[model samples]
Target: MRLTALALLLALPALRADEGMWTFDNIPVQKIKAKYGVALEPSWLKNLQLATVRFPNGTGAFVSRDGLVVTNHHVGRDAIAQMSTAAADLVRDGFTAATRAQEIKVPGLELMMLVSMEDVTAKVNGAVKPGATDQEALTARRNALADLRKADEAKTGLTCEPVTLYQGGEYWLYRYRKFTDVRLAAAPELQVAAFGGDPDNYTYPRHNLDFALFRVYEDGKPYRPDAILPFSAKGASMGELTFISGHPGTTYRQQTHAQMAYARETGIPFQLRAIERQKQALLALSATSPEARRLAAEAIYSLENGHKRLSGQLLGLSKPENLAKVAEAEAALKAAVAKDPALQARVGGSWDRVAQAVARQKALLAEATYLDTGRATLVGRVAALRHAIALVRLADETAKPSAERLSEFSEGNLKATRAQLLSPRPVHKAIDQALLAAGLEEARQALGDGHPFVKAVLGGRTPEAVAKAAVEGTKLDDAAVRRQLAEGGKAVLDASADPMIRLAKAIDPFSRAIRKQMEAEVTGVFNEQGGRIAEARFKVFGKALYPDATFTLRLGYGPVATYANGTGTLAQPFTTYMGMFDRHLGWGGNAAAAEGGVWTLPQRWLDRQVKLDLATPFNFIYACDTVGGNSGSPVVNVKGEFVGINFDSVYEGQGGYYVYDADTKRAVATDVRAILEALRKIMDAGHLADEALGK
Candidate 1:
């Protein structure tokens, strides 16, 4: 009498041309072949998958047999900044290694190459007993996943983690061959790499080099990988089918209406405001002197990018019709489940439960967010505070069983945790003080001075005074001290008289309590109920729909096709090097005044312009589905050859977090030809060019 769930799924609308951040294991081979008429073979997929590498924040790929890795300049900016000093500003002058000995190892940098993956959905889901409470189900799943991670690492000696996709619909254990001995090979000046600066960040029709080179090493020698993307002489052509191989960060396209609502109201605003505060603090610090600006360079750039991106996402969420569309789809899903008694039993209360979780999240958001344990909040940005939180949490989390510890402190993650905690990266006290003071002011504003956290942190003193004391008095900046405290554990931490440590100790109780409550109430419920919702979707849609992104490896395919620019004019898919010169001139820039400001072009580029092939493509736009973490993702043709490096998406495409509109959404990438051209002629880095071309 009624249509089956499978039938309903089949009858629903077909998938769009470019719409998924698909897992490497579940690439839509048939859909890709049918849409673009390019058949992808297993060998090609495997080779590309092996070549692609994941950074902590972005993606990259090996271009030569000698492990010459390529990624965005912004993605590699931290390494460049860290390698810099008051006497040597690498960000301004750029760097090129003439020989292997010249390359410098970047501190605290790790590159993960995905070696293998195995779906463990059944193992994870089966751990939860039927009719168990959300918290119980959550704990069981975590413990189960943690055990799997531990066992896998023990067996293979590779870094391993259980990746949850489709919310909790599927769980896969990804094993990665980790590389920590990463060295910077070559990079262009910031003026060229970030040519147009913040004004042109997420826009198309741009000119930006935005590329950096790094080499992976093993035992103090270059480590060659099994797979590398051969550089294409002719990059992507108009209407050419292309693919992006990278680890896209989180996407909320499949989230429930209640979850989206919470993000729209509380989550996005809080994050956006926090970014604003950080930007202000960094800007003020930068205004002090040249050295201060240099110290604040990496942080300021990061904050500006984050602020712009969050603003775009918030704008998309603020659209009523967007939420209404989500609501309507949710209603249809509810109606579908209502007709099946078994399905109803499994997923009927999922929506209500998620709403309840959202309520709990709202209640805890301010405290949990403001008093974070070094996971990227205003308060957590202080190096000393972050280190203190790590020590505090480590003391507690490490004491618990491996399965019961917090995710960061778990056995599988301990190596990376320790590496980051004890890194010798220099900490700028001025920047730290500014950020901490701003964070405290924000806490006071958000949680009120009467709030226990604010009162305890401020201690009747001004935020500036407290921040100054903590930053100036802390010994956490010394890597040896961090190691000593970390190795000595709780006893050493308790005995420490460092002001930052003392402050961290005072706030540890409230922070830990809030985090625990959040885990049990908000996160636990979401995982349980969200898994049920995913299960219900699986019953209907099967695996035809891709999971939400979780900052894991994925392959998204599209074409280098033009789109109407919302005004009747078709946007050009490619911009040539000549256009770059024209745009520079249009912005009132010239070779003589190269150091003017944001629109400044590096002097080397102007000096070598005549030697360059001005007709070569500089930047191009494609309908590829990409987001923040997709920056530096290797853009390949159907033949699996490296063509361009994905860097940014147009502002219209910011809605991509919620929906994929193939019509208007476009990803901007720097053409490999441009990169090679500049390398050979402008920067005089012929050796790097030869290596990239696999000569």
Candidate 2:
């Protein structure tokens, strides 16, 4: 759809020049042509979209026709960790397969590439009858979506996912070609990949290498892709036009003021506290021994990254100016709706409905957050209790009809769900005990010790005692046991004697109750009423407004440019390899110890420093609108050549969740030139370099 002048004029007060994670089907080609004098042809967009692949947690793209994929090390962290053992420690030493047979098949890893998408908004909305109750409407919509997905999958034999756009204002059926047998082709050491660690995570002028390579396989051979992004040796220049293609996780830019308030006042605080408790436990565990640190490394890194991101988001939301801007934009939109009789009549009470949903959310927050049924799928971090919960829920959910089953258990998602449950990923009992004990205590405090859930879970024992027994006594840790229980169905689940399973069974009722309450009261209202509000927005501003991100494929364009650091200094867009060494040696008065730790240079890099081009761009910043899930995105120029891989965002970019400020916000990426240089000189992977550069 073309963005009209009326749309631009109406949205200019809120939307900026470089704002928007645009959908592939609705890209503003004319706008790009007019602004950058670069014509974005249909073939260019199509190839880019097809090459990009989605991981369980992040994004990547095909870098070679022979199925070599490039993404961030962090995005591939879980796979690397799974491939590591006490004997090998792949995460510490990194891995490179010199031959096709040598490539280690990563267990339970999957990559999905988008094949096509079709708008199904009318078909979904048509499910709801004229005056149905919210719950009925929600149920009908789910049934309709289920039918559509099942039919499409049967007909096409592809993974058909229903992607909710604009909060339910529209729905798109995204069909993907799934690749299950993914292998690790190359990965850098943890120290180099995550250099400067948590301190430099969300800050710019970053020097982390942060890139990894993978290859998808079919029948034990490399899977060739139809489209691949050619690696560019020249890379991106300062102020040059660039585009990022990836899946950005989530954003609340379209949220109402009440919803934002709920997030600020209630939701984020609860999550922050929960993460703090878990992080402290992991840190204490890490301090014990080298082995302990190895076991807890991925979890600690993830928690620390999340803590910083959420803290920045909270700070941004707390700022008076930011809040006032959100309020003003919402007010303007509402006022515009009020002035238009047709829009007012259509969406008169949408704001109030969303506010009411927020109130319901606040009332149920404690129960809903703590008793969450699906938390175990987080890279298998949680202990037996969460796994037990998954088993119990699966037994129940799988028994229901396809249309009536929970979304996670739907036909389209069952394969991934089953894969996650049966994954043979290593689990550390001690660390699990600590985290589980912490979670139990947190629940006790939040829901009160007298609460039914707390009572059922604790069962008159201390949180520590319960967690110890659950982790030590449960056989759910064994993949075979989980498989048996999963395949045996409810009778087997009901007969299981495992402490964790018993506990899961004990608390299953309360969990289901809260989940039902959440679905009927909070989520249903948000979707139904939120759709109306979206309609009101479209009526006022037209279709030019981008939808909130839903972790689906999107294309964002920007320029390689510097920005003010908010401290009377202009932060440069590029950082050189010399800067990385200086930071390691504490030459900038940075706190990284000169002798060792995360900032310490890898031995190979230190040995090859004289052979390297110190002036080569190591990392650079761009003004692209990005969020968490865009981490491994391939940043390409107009010619569709890969110049860099997007990794982190500066602290200021955290506010991009609600607003895009091109002045201060910057997306950080590793320069393709740096990757090439390191591969050729320092890493002793010239063959890999040759392949990447298409030699």
Candidate 3:
């Protein structure tokens, strides 16, 4: 989806003062069902499975009765990238299956379904009450939930996930069954799939034919999924009931206004800056080294997502309408609570405390760029060695087969470092320097000033010097490093006197501690805020917020058109192939833009001009609420048939995590027909196309 004027339109004025407040519990699901004439039965709801894809970080839907899954091409890019080699650049050239046998299988990836949900609010609240301190409350809540999870796991055959919803406003135990045998069915070329590229990402009038097909396989056969919905060409009708079932990662909707302010003032800015720095590093490394290029691709992906999301959050906050809505909501909530003395007393000064925290962290947050720390260098190598050591130790202590341990350790280490080494740029002098510096600092922190390795690395010389030497002195080429590690594996263990090797040995624990501290701080905030919201919401709104996602099947439905911002100007929900060419021409100067040269067409455009495929009919627009985990969700028509794959939303949609706007709000999805046609015609993957189309 292209980020366009549609974003501005979705910014509707706050709900009228007279309109009764509504929560998720009061969402009138039955009313929506009656209005759309769609069945709201649990059976129908259960048919929608949340399709979770990890690489590009998104979700999808399973649409065929025969285990055929539909998701966005971007979502599956990671798996495809993993399987690609220089000789076979799947990402650049694209992948196709001439026959069913040619289909590529993605290992260690799974599609999951939530089997059931049990509201555990009463039990959870019983353990921790309103008067407890944050730590006390957190511990109580954790213990309760832990017990609940174990009990639920025993009761349900599925994996039990105890979730504190609305932060800690409520609790629900969710049961899920995960399926691992997922295979790549088909995908379109870069031209059609990523039609408008980043310039048009998350916007309407979007020409992006961003869709892909995958299938769930089990026991050497395609899994006969019970929840698959059939596809229909005629999209969802106006005002028809539609449900989007996918994994929605997280939302800060229940956050206090102070929390929102904190995220805007502190979190978002820091993330954006960090992403920019990482992007710079990755780009430089990619330009200089082929190994860095491949290895950095994954890092680049992570950074891009962070960049896009943070950018979206910032942009979303910048919109006058969005700011107004948030202000109004907070005001209304505050006023209502003030009228209730009990509520006012309960939440007294909490918002102020949160605000103070934000203020305190503001400067540090801004400076907290991930790249400034110089931690990435020896971190991977150190982690690899530690894992190897752990495996060796475990093998020595346990009855487990030595061969199995060796294989597992070797594979684990290889997988961990594969992306780093394979990156387009590989490790460069700058990155190496930063990494070594970070590693040495980490070693000093972990092993203290007296540690032999730390002393050798830090003895009068700086990390910069050590890094320069490491890069310039040794035959530390990627292949050479791998070979040396493989051949001299036990030699390092035998030589306790080697200061350089010992320093290398201490790298892992130091890096791990650094990462652990950062993670702990982040998680602590998330959990604390989550708990607060969950508790307050339960006290105020009651069962309004739904349970946390258990990778369960769900159905979210809205409409298939652009949102009306105000004044009759509708952000047209769809874009055509012509727009692709226009965008390409507009961004001709950028190398990234030039890579989209396939869209700059005269013959292909003319030949395919009249095709409805070119007209972008199947790419429907919706104010349907979604999040990162909601990737690959099937945008269905009123008939509950698949229309497109929901992939992205505009930068302004980040705040949609809390409040949804029927106006400027738009979700970017790929039309199923376009996907099928692209695979069949452009990519020549006819067999896979037939399967995807249910032929």
Estimated TM-score for each candidate: 0.95, 0.94, 0.73
After superposition, which runs of candidate 2 have C-alpha atoms over 4 Å from their true positions?
1-17, 375-383, 410-416, 587-596
The true-versus-predicted C-alpha distance at residue 527 of model 2, in Å, is 1.0
Model 2 backbone overlap count? 0
RMSD, one per candidate, in order = 5.8, 5.1, 8.2
Candidate 1 lDDT at 486 equals 94
Candidate 1 ranges with C-alpha deviation above 4 Å: 1-17, 374-376, 590-596
Any runs in candidate 3 off by more than 4 Å, and if so which? 1-27, 34-39, 49-56, 126-132, 150-157, 236-241, 289-295, 319-328, 334-345, 356-534, 545-555, 563-569, 577-618
Best by lDDT: 1
Error of 2 at 337 (Å): 2.1
Please give the ranking of all candidate structures by TM-score, highest first, separated by commas.
1, 2, 3
lDDT of 2 by residue, 1-695 (tens): 35695663343232222788999988988888998899999999999999999998899999887889999999999899888888998888888887778888987788999999999889999988999977778877877877788788899999888888887788889999999999998888887889988878888788999999999999888998889898998999977889999999999988888998888888788778888889988889889988888889888889989989988888778877877888899889889989989888878888898899899999987778777664422113575666777788899988888767877677756765687778776566878887878777878887898898888778899988987887899888788999999999999998998988887887778767877888888888998888888888887778888899999999999888767667666676799999988888874333555333767766777778899999999999887889999999999999999999999988876877876666656789999999998788876677877877777
Candidate 3, lDDT over the whole model = 0.55
In the predicted model 2, the residue pairs found to clash are none
Give the per-residue lDDT digits (tens) of candidate 1, residues 1-695.
25685564443222223888989889999988786678899999999999999987899999999989999998998888889888988888888888989999987788999999999989988888988887778777777787788888899999887898888888889999999899999999998899888887777778899999999999988998999997898888876788999988989988899999988888888888888888988899889999999989889888888878877787777878788889998998899899999999889999998999999999988788876563447556788788888888788889998777777788766765787889877777888899999988888898898998888888899889999999999989888998999999888888989998888887778777787788788888888788889888888878898888898999998878666556555567799889888878877785444444667777777888899889999999887888889999999987788999999988777877886667656788999999999888877688988888878
Worst lDDT 10-window in candidate 1: 8-17
